[model samples]
Target chain A: MEEFEPKIVAFCCHFCAYSAADLAGSMRLQYAPNIRIVEMPCSGTIDHRVLLKALEDGADGVFVAGCMEGDCHFLKGNYRAKRRVSHVKDLLRAIGLEPERLEMYNLSAAMGPRFAEIANEMTARVKGLGPSPFRKQTGGDA
Target chain B: MIVAEQKPLAEIAGMIGDCRKVLFAGCAGCVTVCLSGGEKETEVMATALRMKRQLEGNPLETVTYTATRQCDPEYVDAMADVVKGVDAVVSLACGVGPQYLAARYPDLWVIPAQNTTFAGGSKEHGVWEEFCGLCGQCVLHLTGGICPVIRCSKSILNGPCGGSQYGKCEIGKDVECAWHLIYERLKRLDRLDLMRQYREPKDWSKARDGGPRKVTREDVMIG
Candidate 1:
């Protein structure tokens, strides 16, 4: 049987993480293909519900990749995203979910290597955790 | 407007524990202004529920919808499509919205996300207090705009009770003595005589004690 590969959703900031992924493509950086990228004008546009929908849709893990601290193209966008991510973590934990499933990272658009690095890191972390129980195949539906 | 406070998250989570397909219904009315329920909150709750279910190995199906005013029938009717296949409806409006939903959708299980508090205004950002006691009597003008009925811990109409000291109430030092506020305002207006006027004891019969209140404006009636 093939080992379960975790599905991960990455919200990439248009100004940074998205561009960094593009840069990674140009650099031919080999990384895990398990991560799906959703491009947003800014991390601030990543609402709490979107994150929840991804998890409900069976994503094993979620991440927000935004500009480095104090460097958001839309000033303070990353900061706002950080706060929202933390709040979501609390809400998740309160509901019996591992807060670690949701994460926020700050990096510049030029950091292609970092993007691959995080992609590899998250994929491994999720793999160790096994498949998401929410997946339709897991018999998790009530 | 009807005001409300968000129900504790733990409590809400427990209520929806067995639900799979759920509709998070939020009201864009008083609860929205108070930050208890709104479009953003509706989404937040749906996400939380989804994540929780996934973690528990009992994944849930959740959707979010916001009504213009859940207390209104027409607005609530808009949720028909969203609630179509859901097993339950979690309402984020005040006390009125859940009752309205339950009444309209007798077949659907309805739950409340907020605890109806009172008819009040936000004293400041994120802080709300009871302002109108719904006494059915307007006495604010006589008290220099400070409502003694709701602000005063004792609801004393004559003046500040002996418990007042240094401009605070005895019930709690942090509480600003409502009558002290009245006195200061009256003094500023140089209307000290207003406090000297003897007022009769309140008639509770005409207030909320009379049962569910009703107000009819003849001129405003279409018929």
Candidate 2:
């Protein structure tokens, strides 16, 4: 059997995490290639549907990367995102999926190294968890 | 407005057992404002059901439709096209939605996905408390706008029932004694004298004891 390569979807706020990813690339950081970063206006804009859609479309894991606590460009966008992420986690668990498959992180735009670190960390965690049950049931690829 | 809560996913799944296709009908009325049933909840339910059934090796197809107001026959009639093909309909609206859908499509099976909890409004985001007992009477004027029929555990007309202590009801510490609240409010409004007036028993004829009720306005009737 081929080694499992998890597909991870990372929703990054444009004001922070997305910029951090760009900075990570500019700084020659080597992060996990498995992370697929999706840019949004703000982490708060990442709706529950978008997260669930990522999983339904074969993502092994999904995470939202937002601005550091109390530092959101929109004041409370990151806080709202935190609450929404928690709600989605509960929904995921109710559907029999591993709640750990989804996560939320906060970091500043200048934290390029942390961005790469999170990508690698999330990728490793998802790899350990293997493919999502939805992927397994649908006979999807690794 | 009516407040409702979605039934457990497991119970809903069991109710839809062996059905290959189901329609999830959502209401854009009170349930939407209450966050119980609406377009978002309907989609969430469909996704959850599809995921659950797929994992069990019995893939289920789900269609989602949201009516303007499920309690109205005209709005429910709008779903005729979509309702034709589904094996069953799982209404995410309050109890009224399923009954209306069932009435509209007599041949199709309609089931409720929510427990019609009460008529109330949200005290805050994601929290709702019962406010009306649907007793077919309005006594808020006499009670200083506080409803004792539903808010009070015992529905005492003249009470802080003997079990009331610290303004809380005996039934639960979390529940405030409704009569006490009414008294305080009336006191503040300088209508405390209303509390002393001997209250007559509530007339049950106007309530559910009279069976299913209807409100008609002859002036608004169409030819």
Candidate 2, residue B40: the lDDT equals 91
Model 2: residues with Cα > 4 Å off, grouped in runs: A136-142
What C-alpha lDDT do the candidate models reach, one value each?
Answer: 0.87, 0.89
Q: Report the number of the highest-DockQ candidate.
A: 2
Question: Which pairs, if any, clash in model 2?
Answer: none
Give the TM-score of each candidate: 0.77, 0.94
For model 1, the docking class works out as medium
Which pairs clash in the backbone of model 1?
none
For model 1, the superposed segments whose C-alpha errors exceed 4 Å read A1-4, A16-34, A67-75, A108-121, A136-142, B16-23, B50-65, B73-88, B103-109, B122-130, B158-177, B180-199
Error of 2 at A138 (Å): 11
Measured with C-alpha atoms, the lDDT of residue B155 in candidate 2 is 75
- Where does candidate 2 chain B have its weakest 10-residue lDDT segment? B48-57
